[model samples]
Target: MSCKVIDTHSQLAYVVRMIHCVCNNINTAKVDAAAARGAESAACVQRACGTKFNCGQCREDINHRLAAWRALNPMLEAAE
Candidate 1:
């Protein structure tokens, strides 16, 4: 039997902190924190982080992050 090798670079890329909002300098950690604080929308997340949309390009990524957060917290979704 042969052993399998993992692509460490790809794994590292996946674990790296991403800048979800380049304009506001907001990263995934900030988005996650906002989601934990009950921010249901991108605007709410930005507001919670003391920022706002400038170019609107980050909306999709922010929404994606919010969706992931919601998926992980089903009880919070039920409460909302």
Candidate 2:
């Protein structure tokens, strides 16, 4: 039998699915789109994605993704 080794610390193992606002059927793609379209804040994301103020569980997570996405793609920011 051949021995196979798996890397527990691999980056793929740490990959996380971005699910923002499940109640409103929103996902990472939607959030990214919104962020790219000038959603610099969670409130803006909620509004743009029609999430509104539901259970409020996704609020923090959305904000986090927004900040990260913006940091990575600085050019997506809308001109003020």
Encode model 2's per-residue lDDT on 1-80: one tens digit a residue.
99999867544322455577877877777778888788877778888977686888888988888877766666655443
lDDT for every model? 0.85, 0.74
Clashing pairs in 1: none
Tens digit per residue, CA lDDT, model 1, 17-75: 79999999999889888988889889998999998899989999899888977776789
Candidate that scores best on TM-score: 1
- TM-score of every prediction relative to native: 0.73, 0.68
lDDT over C-alpha atoms for residue 13 of model 1: 38
Which regions in candidate 1 have their CA more than 4 angstroms from the true location? 1-16
